[model samples]
Target: MTTDNRSTLFSPLTLPTPDGTGFALRNRTILSPMCQYAVDRQDGVATDWHLQHYGAVAAGGFGLLTIESTGVNAAGRISPRDLGMYNETQEAAHRRLVSFIHSQGAAAAVQLNHAGGRASGKPWLPGTHGGSAPLEDGGWQTVGMTDQSIAKGYRPTTKLSKDGIEQIVSDFAAAARRADAAGYDVIQIHAAHGYLLHQSLSPLTNTRDDKYGGTEENRFRLTREVVDAVRAAWPDSKPLGIRISATDWVAGGLDVDVTSRLMRDLVKNHGINWVDVSSGGLVSTPLQPSGPGFHAVLGAQIKRALADTDAVVSVVGGISSPEQAETMLRTGQVDAVSIGRAAMRNPHWPAMAAARLGVPCEDNPAAPQYWRAEW
Candidate 1:
């Protein structure tokens, strides 16, 4: 196969940045951010485990690797072991990781998140899958849009006051500054999976009568503010992106139509350059579909909705097979595919997929040292 004959999955994608100069990705495959929960000291700093873990994926040929959920504040972490972007120590560690990823010919992105009511929970490692970590075990009270539990085993959260909400926005902006300092190519604001921003977006979670809740526009206030703040803080040369659960999968909850509108506005008016679509984290419901390429349709809809803009749309689900991913891209379902568990199972997934898709070996995105490794 020749370069011109290469599959869309192996082709480059340039994401538009605020500066008008685009951020070029070597290929269309992105490594979805997955939590490792390996921070030994629980101080929210990246450790050796993080370096090796992300390094492996970078060398594995991903065009972009999104670092897992990182807290903007200590109390906002999903687990004590999750990463944070607030301090000098964490920022330095992240810089080290980004340098290594770039050396391997990959771009690095960090997902800035505030888990809200879901914070301070047990890591999802074996034998400690669910429930909030007790205070004695280093857990703290979580905060949310309302004083409610996001899930059954999670602790009930304190409702965030107007001041608290403002603080949250400030924290995200501060984190964005740190991310730029760390030399990240992109910053993904995590508004999905029932986090603080998602809580405010979903009617099932946000019931406040204040300006930050109730009507759809009011519910969207916090996320919009955070986006504005981060965009203002972050350098215009780097692209800004977001991960959103396109649907809540239950009646009277957020769905594709609403989220599509949000994406359009974010791309057209705000400074978002990319959107990664996922769904159903506010509450567990059977209505949420499952299986391979589950979020492809939603991604396509959002892509079509943002057709007039230069925003790139990606989808994450059971997108394991190379053929399925290729078909999705070839059919214009999404601009890119975010591989999760499959990438974990095989860190060199992109390299192998490139070979399977018949991309010429010289053009394969694999690290130079791995070029001789038979795919």
Candidate 2:
């Protein structure tokens, strides 16, 4: 409903690269990282659920598809079954999924993450009707930057020593290698949503007095180091992206101004190509200003703030329609749009959007066995 007639969301978008590799998207549509939690732990396999689920989106024509925030460490998982990149067993499953997505002409992207303070919890548990697993036994007893998280009912975390920081950076590089092996064309570092890296970036959670905390520069040290390490390990042919909270939306949290400055530094200095703008996920009672285009406005502002930086920006959060997305793109508020919930609601969203905008494209790209004559 909040559409401007002359928008560019339907137009083809080509992203810039610091490494001089050329990549062009058929459109500005992107699929943000949304957790599917459909992995089998025993064999580390992705079920037909993954193929069918993601295949639908690729077939539907989203230009870029970012898989969920895959855990770099097993204990750092958001849930026991969350997708992972720590070992070969997990990497093989992702490879199969990516092959199918690429065959459909959608760019495959992966979000590598570590859930520091917010790790391991059952998404749904019954009350009193049955017993459940603790985070250590499959519930959330994860560590954090300080002792404050434990007081808030989260797991007490070991304050990361310099060596621990180095290991995390190593984990991220390994994950990027796995992504490269798995045929991912794009890699996104998940530093947003109150995760491990974001925790280090925030003063509210990260209370360390050492180089990893204190001043803003110190706070950002971990993220910068991680990005640099990942850039080194990842192939120069692929574009690397970073997702940031943009605005924690809570008092004493990382706001857009800080995030904007960080975005500029990450892009200009560290060789990051894109910044996926999402908000919240770091609070027990997050102050989310829920509505249409709320986060998009933040995206617009951050993009403007970083006008000098060459990094391409993608905005996600409550974007429900192509019309709304186009308005933002046409105005150059953001370089691209990422839709999650809406795409889940309609796997054919991109196809529907193309039709609405009078673009030429296929509705579904799955095997004929799945979507035959109907498509």
Identify the leading candidate in terms of TM-score.
1
lDDT of each: 0.93, 0.78
Error of 1 at 271 (Å): 0.6
- For every model in order, what is the number of clashing pairs? 0, 6
**Candidate 2: where are CA atoms >4 Å away?**
1-7, 42-44, 124-137, 150-153, 361-375
What is the C-alpha lDDT profile of model 2 across 109-197, one tens digit per residue? 98898887666655434442112236354564565677555224455666666887788789889989988998998899999877888
Task: State how far residue 192 of model 2 sits from its true place (Å).
Answer: 1.1
